[model samples]
Structure formats: C-alpha cells, structure tokens
Target: MKKFSYFLAVMFLFTAFAPAAMASAPEKSNKEDKELTPEQEERLEEIKSRVDEIKSMDFSSMSKAEIKDVKKELRGINKETKAMGQGVYLSVGAIIIILLILILLT
Candidate 1:
C-alpha cells in the first residue's frame, strides 16, 4: 500500500510538470524575426494575442472540452484567412482581363 501511494505521488508530479517544462523550451528558428515582412509580423502578433488571451483564461474552473474548442477556433481563423487570400488573387486576375477586353472593344 505504501509503495502504491508513492508511485501515485510521483506520477502526479510528472503529469503536472512535464508539459509546463516542455512548453518553456524554446523552439529553433528556421528564419529570423527581424527579417519577417510587415504582413508576417502582423499575422504573428494576431496569433500571439489570441494565444495570450487563451492562456490568461481561467482554466482552473473549466473542462478539457472547452480548451479543445479554443484550439479549433484558432485553426478556423487561419483557414478562413488563407481562403480570403486565394479569393483576392482571383479577383485581381479577373479585373485585369476585364480591363484588357474593354480596351479592345473601344
């Protein structure tokens, strides 16, 4: 019984500290932050702000399911932005083609 209790205590410590320790370890950069363009900086700031909000969130009183929803929301925002860029490219091409046809007709 004593051995089992000790094992449970160690297991609890690992479960609590492992993720926090790993999260603090810095990831290696394939690119420099200063070299990033304005658009890239803006996107990074937007994501950082969102994650900050999520981190400040009171997880002490919430369930795991709610945390999952927050991740899903962030992913959805990224997908929407990518689609909007594609739409903008399509619109620009169509406008150029229309202008060329109008010039030819006149």
Candidate 2:
C-alpha cells in the first residue's frame, strides 16, 4: 500500500510538471504559431455548423438506427478535427504507461 501510494505520488508529480516543462521550450518562428490554413479554417467552420445542427436535433424522436448514424457522423467529424489540429496528443492510457516506464527506469 505504501509503495502504491509512492507510485501515485510520482505519477501525479510527473503529470503536473510535464506540461510546464513542455511549455517552457523555446518558441519557433511565427509560421509555427499558425495552426491551420485558410482552407482548413473554412472546413472547420463547416464542421462546427454540422455539430451545431446535431446539437439542435431532437434525438428523442429519432429511431435507434438514426441515432446510431448521428453518433457515427459525430465520430467521423471528431477524427477529422483531430487530424486537422497540429500537436503531439497523448491519451491518458499512453501517459500512464509512459509514467510507469519512467518510474521503473529510475
């Protein structure tokens, strides 16, 4: 139990400090600051409109299949949005595994 607590403590510290460390890295040129191009920006606006339409929908009146289709569409839009963004995104599971590896190595 004590060892588990220590592991959690280390993991918490790592998760808290990791973002700070990454943020402190030297900035690049202004080009790197621009996340998306004009075409991508237009597409993003379309996506936002579609999402808003979905939100304004009456889901309760829809059939199960229709609901399923809406969910699938949302998932596709989510993937596309993520693909359009530029960054190294780490999932929670990946972060935990990385922290474990660092802990074991130390």
Candidate 3:
C-alpha cells in the first residue's frame, strides 16, 4: 500500500506539469515587424521631438548644410513613425474587419 501511494502521488505531479511543458506559444503574424527595445523606443521619441523643434524654426535664411541636417532629422522621424504606424494599422484593420464579419453574420 505504501509503494502504491507513492506511485500515485508521483503520477499526479507528472501529469500536472506535462501539458504545460509541451504546450507551444502562439506564433506572431508575418505582417508584424520586430519591435524596438525600450531604449530604442525612448531614443526614437527623442529624435522625433528634436525634429519637430527644428521644423518649427524658420529656415528661410539657413545655409544648405543646416537645411540638409533638418531634412535628415525629419526623414529619420518619418521612418520611425512609419514603422511604428504599420503595426497599429494592421491591428485596427483586423479589428474593423472582424467587426464587419460579425455584423454580416448576425
């Protein structure tokens, strides 16, 4: 009886852990891009703010290099914003389509 009770307890423990060990995480969508690290995100925000400040300045009398630098900063901000914007667009589009399908089905 002692040996049989130990076997049952060990069996219960293994069963409880087995499924979790074998289960897989769901895969991300192909439309999704790699996310930036926390540090990268903060830097990106800083870059955007700097670009906005530069744009708000009057550039009429600026030299070629100054205009070029401002343009470069603006492009960098646009690229980062576009990349971040893509994920949001995909998510909102998916939600809207799902809602439309549900409306049609009902």
Q: Against the true structure, what is each candidate's TM-score?
A: 0.34, 0.57, 0.39
Steric overlap count per candidate: 0, 0, 0
What is candidate 2's TM-score against the reference?
Answer: 0.57
Kindly list the per-residue Cα lDDT of model 1 for residues 37-106, writing each as its tens digit.
6776587678668868987999778788987888798677667555434212334335545765786699
lDDT ranking from best candidate downward: 2, 3, 1
In candidate 3, the residue pairs with backbone N, CA or C atoms under 3 Å apart (3 or more residues apart, or in different chains) clash, namely none
Which candidate model has the greater TM-score, 1 or 2?
Answer: 2
Can you write out model 3's per-residue Cα lDDT over 1-106, one digit (the tens) per residue? Answer: 7985786577566666755654665555544566777877887778767867886898899999999987887777778767664323444335545765786699
lDDT of 3: 0.68
Query: Relative to the unseen true structure, what is the C-alpha lDDT of residue 67 in candidate 1, on a scale of 0 to 100?
Result: 75
Model 2 error, position 57 (Å): 1.1
TM-score of 3: 0.39
The alpha-carbon RMSD values of the candidates against the true structure, listed in the order shown, are 25.6, 7.9, 18.7
Model 2, range 1-106, lDDT digits (tens) per residue? 8998997888788777877876798866544456788999899999999999999999999999999999999989989987776334775547798877897899
- Please name the candidate that would achieve the greatest lDDT relative to the true structure: 2
Task: Quote the lDDT for 28 in model 1.
Answer: 70
Note the Cα lDDT for every prediction shown: 0.65, 0.83, 0.68
